[model samples]
Target: MDNNSCGCNVCSTREDLPWEGRGTDLPIAGCRFTLYPMTDRYVDIILGSLEKTDTSYVWSETDALSTVYRGKLPYVADAVKALFVNAYRSGVHMALEGQFSKGCPGDIAGDSLLEKDGEAPNAKSAEGIHFPVKCKLALYPMGVGNYIDDIAKVWYMAQDRGLEPTTIHYATRISGDVHDVFDYLRDVCALMDESAVSHYILHFTVNCNSPTKE
Candidate 1:
């Protein structure tokens, strides 16, 4: 692939091969945000908790649910929310929390590659919106060098079709609307080949809201 730059799904310069309509703009998910803490406390804690769980739990734990919950230690439903509160106070956005769940070694929840449906006209009739999207993201786990680069490629593709970048999180603060929240799950799943993950959870701090919120 050539290093072609893209802005809002279209090549600001010109539509080169693989550049025209290359990115699909999907609607953003509702009511979600990222956490960015300056000192990395939130991310450290979350990843630390996750690390506690053996990456190879499939060989040890028989119960799939238990294995996943173990990583989300102190396993509270508001695991991410709790982190967000702390991070928000301390000025952080380290977790990079997603809608679906952490793509830990064995997460299988929402494992299927889904497609995104644009914002509906009367989407406000319910508390949660399920985006039936057909999307695929390839992850080179150990290939750390260009993971960021590759993700950018996919990101642009999404943005082109109308899937906008909801916000950028850093030091615990966020800058996006509800749509971004909805897409968070898809973005996370796309970033990691989450199909292999056994079990997972996504925290919707704002209940009256999602599978997590409720």
Candidate 2:
């Protein structure tokens, strides 16, 4: 195989491709996120965070909208957490909007990433960094017949964890330490089963140091 070749469902030259033999059961994950820093120094904050965070385990790209990370789930999650924490500035309201996806039928470009493995390198260093955050998230478990029931179960799960989420239009709001929010999200993502969902996406926004008077 050439270094540039992609052995995915759409490009594989092999007769017995995995997807054809069984199915497209890759564990590839991705995250696209944009950070909004509430200050004139926003550019510095965004760039600085990118510099400090370690994204070596993942394939990453940045454009006008947001930074996209594609790789194993742990690397994708840890990269997001480390970047957000690195960008934290006290008294400056910062917002990060992100979309995390797994098992998407169209996501074949990063299939090679599955061969790469190990713990997220930056996760250890970013541990124990605490900050308050308010977040809103919408979870979609695709192709499930009773999606509302699954969604409701997540709501109840959050309540059980003592992270009572407030119902808002199009999303649910949860307030807590940054670590807790991320942990909750990890669990939420884990709730999806391969046999049930064709694809799953979690759209969320985390805000810290907001100046909102409410």
Candidate 3:
């Protein structure tokens, strides 16, 4: 055990104890998500999306309520983005709610994914897919002081990316192309200060192809 390593869950959750490191070290990441496509063909949409998206670099498990995908950060993001985009339809409304987490103590169930190599298999196939989506994300930078400032930084990044963010009570809502929205969310997870905030979580909800006016 090094100076940065800790054994207690409380310390890890409170971020009072640091782990080996999250940067470049490739700490495990995961997201559990549920997708709702508001159309009679929702069953087809869900099944088709799952079949179309590649999960070669990620480990995934699905059940009645939601699906959990875990792996290296980038691969996880790739899988997530591909899944949502593959399921999108021009006329039907679709929504996905997900909880993303990284560096949780004892979260090694998907450690095997680290052994897999190469880029996310879905990355190449998902290219050039574009559609509009409305998204809001609540980022929790665990144990970091001035956390609100960090959140504001993400908001600013969204604006810079032309996402058109709107401040809501608990989360910041942004609207833009699905590709950009997913990329921004992925960038947030990858670009944060890994040493300062060891464990961070994001509650994200995104919807697309909606009939309702906004």
* TM values, all candidates: 0.26, 0.84, 0.85
- Residue-level lDDT for 78 in candidate 2: 85
Q: At residue 22, give the lDDT of candidate 3.
A: 29
Identify the runs in model 2 with alpha carbons over 4 angstroms from their true place. Answer: 1-24
Count of clashing pairs, candidate 1 = 41
lDDT by residue (tens digit), candidate 2, 111-130: 33656676778878888689
Off by over 4 Å in 3: 1-26, 109-112, 193-195
Q: What is the lDDT of residue 58 in candidate 1?
A: 19
User: Candidate 1: which stretches are off by over 4 Å?
Assistant: 1-143, 161-180, 194-214
Q: Global lDDT of each model?
A: 0.31, 0.80, 0.81
What tens digits encode model 1's per-residue C-alpha lDDT throughout 1-214? Answer: 1222322243445545443433222211111234333453644744454443322211112232222212221121123323332223222223333233332222222312224223321233222423222212232322134445644554564565464433333111122333343344335444443332222233322211122221
User: Model 3, residue 204: what's the lDDT?
Assistant: 99
Report the Cα lDDT for residue 159, model 3. Answer: 90
Q: Write the per-residue lDDT of candidate 3 for residues 1-214, one digit (tens) a residue.
A: 2223333455545654343342334567889999999989999999999989998888889899999888888898899999998998887899999988875543544343777778678888888888889998999876566778878888898999999998999889999888899999998887664435576788999998777875
- Model 2 poorest 10 in a row by lDDT: 1-10
Error (Å) of candidate 2 at residue 127 is 1.3
Top candidate by lDDT? 3
Cα displacement (Å) at residue 119, model 1? 18
Per model, state how many residue pairs clash: 41, 0, 0
